[model samples]
Target: MEVVNQFVVSPCVSVCEVDERDICVGCLRTLDEIARWGVMSHEERMHVMTELLPLREAGDVT
Candidate 1:
């Protein structure tokens, strides 16, 4: 028998909300990105993170 490994995703249990600065208090996802995450591709998520990094550094969100 062969054993397979499964990947687990983050739970994002934070109750953070999207602030006017476009950062989620919890997940820190931008408003536009968060609104589109369900339909976005993995590449898109990567792009969003690129945009988010700067904001995070500036203390925009958690």
Candidate 2:
């Protein structure tokens, strides 16, 4: 696998809201994930991006 050196393209769609489970409605990131994004390494952000699917499927976000 290749490691990307730039900040992962943010999944945010300008609609920022967290559901009761703490998942963002816009990007499907949890509150902790969102809070940590700015300081996270590029690879870290990418990993977080990849983790969104399960959150979405689990009904955490639309």
Compare the candidates by TM-score and give the number of the best one.
2
Model 1 misplaced stretches (Cα beyond 4 Å): 1-11, 54-62
**Candidate 2: segments with Cα more than 4 A from true spot:** 1-5, 54-62
> Which pairs of residues clash in candidate 1, taking residues 3 or more apart in a chain or in different chains?
none
Model 2 per-residue lDDT tens digits across residues 1-62: 99756857778788999888887777788788888889998778877777655658686644
| Worst 10-residue lDDT window, candidate 1 | 4-13
Instruction: Report how far residue 17 has shifted in candidate 1, in Å.
Output: 1.6
lDDT of each: 0.62, 0.76
Tens digits of per-residue lDDT, candidate 1, 10-57, equal: 224476676777677676666666677777776666655566655685
Q: Please report the candidate that would top lDDT against the real structure.
A: 2
